[model samples]
Target: MGSPDPNGRQLDGLGGGISSLSKICVVGPPTRPGVDVEFTFVQVGVKNSDIDYSGNCGNLSSAVGPFAVDSGIFRPLKDSGDVSVRIFNTNTGKVIESTFPVCDGEAVAQGDFAIDGVAGTASKVKLDFMNPGGSKTGGMLPTGNVVDCMDGIRATCVDVGNPSVFVSAEELGIDGTILPDETQNMPRLLERLESIRQKATMMMGMADSPEEVPASIPKICFVSQRNSHMLLSGERLEADSVDVVVRAISVGQPHKALPITTSLSLAVAAKIPGSIVHQHARSGVENKEELVIGHPSGKLVVGAKLDDNGEVERATVYRTARRLMDGIAYWK
Candidate 1:
């Protein structure tokens, strides 16, 4: 059991500097079939480091459904069925309804599925983007402009959940397979990327620079195509090599796992006619249900419905999250 603060931030093991561990709760409507499911996020102090609630964890989002089902907060209606959960993130006031397959009247937790940043295999949980482009900025393109030239780089800025500026990795004199440590360790490179992020942030109308109050929006990513196996956890992932690869950063750090919404944005950008991801998308009707992206960790599969007229109906993917513990966490 742990103690949570007024805002749900946890406080435990505060003897040394450590990143805050998060505790989330998935609350489903007690008696309604299609009601909203509230997701409560808590930032637990890592015993020493700063407590952070500045971002929501999509990986934790994976655990919400299972937690709801396991806790009986949301009763299972069938042996194997689809359960939709409308997530109310207390931190951002954003709503995300993620659905997944259930087994034996319970949320499935075992399957032949694996994600880049996560450790082992688990059941496949899919997320559907209803609007596909309106999660963050309330519009497809946050700046209302498709292309924005900043710091001598041409980029496409869009907001699906977190705002991101998409550009090519080749322009930055690197392959798309750069490791997280290597990239983050390079102060000059990081500064340059941060410069782009600041400019893109301003372009997205979020903030002028890093000096200002950091907005929980607008991530910046560089993209390129990869022909080689993606390196993850010291292993290579075997998949179709696409021409467009994306490297995105959140809060000045390479996300261990790509945000679910950002991954959705990648799927849509891959389908659009003029974006950088156009070449990686399926060209014909023969195979149209899958979109796999090569990230620094590995490739992520995204499913979507698209039209020739450039309209994307929905984008989906499978992921896993688990409730590590529950109780209360004190912030202050």
Candidate 2:
């Protein structure tokens, strides 16, 4: 991916000039036992040269299994039917079990299952994040508290799929349904959120000072109770269809959709009493394992299973991926 381009278009490389589009995944044979493949996720910067490997990408993880099967990194026992791939992410030291359909020794790319953000329907790829707690920091509650006061606002810092800080959008004096373009125009709101995020980063021990914080880790989002809102697609999302509403910031820009890791952390936070997310989420969500989160693009349903100790045992999310291309390029 291109970097250090002031224009930010990344015309010299494969980057799409967006953080989500500027990513790379290196897959290889597993070094550890009981793992089918080991992959490293690289977050390349579009406008800057900062290559961050601080956290895992939930969206990209969905594509690894199919890639493994098609690339022959992990061969399926059956030529046709369902298969599972155990993947170890080097960035987070977590295992993700990817299960999908295969036909004639190739991963199937056509199906009826659909997900938000991406257009059209395709084969469903089920990803079960095993023991996703403490992905980056050392504990689920990295700050040792369910809620911490950051920048004079109450926030819940969680580290399930990734370290995340959640606050109530109502307390921030902003509508929860603000679109990404609208968020870009509010400099002060962005500054305040960055301040809170930096503070949370320090409190979570991800960095010693504000300047040392990586741009990609420690995601921050604001939450609100389920309410009717318009999605980025201009479709109405009813209140009864979702359990909570969230607006997340990624790499200092408003995200078009919720990150999978952030969704995992939010699902975990929703189960914790007294958390800012729990307080703002729809009532009676604690007893339920699945949490439907409404974002700018659409709603995502994530499931979090808690063990006997009430800690997150696993987190589940479904996604769809298809091979865009397969080739090699020269970069200098």
CA-lDDT, candidates in order? 0.61, 0.93
RMSD of 1: 5.1
Q: Give candidate 2 misplaced runs (Cα > 4 Å).
A: none
lDDT of 1 by residue, 1-332 (tens): 13433333333422222121333343555342334566655434432233445445555666776777777767766768777766566544555567877878777777777777778987777665554555545566677666777778777776654466777677677666677777777677667777877887776666666565243345667776655654657777543544345677765666554666677667666655666556434454124567667777777777767666555566667787654556664544
Off by over 4 Å in 1: 1-34, 40-56, 79-82, 88-95, 101-106, 208-210, 213-216, 237-243, 279-288, 306-311, 326-332
Q: Number of clashing residue pairs in every model?
A: 18, 0
Per-residue lDDT tens digits for candidate 2, residues 198-221, read 999999999999999989988999
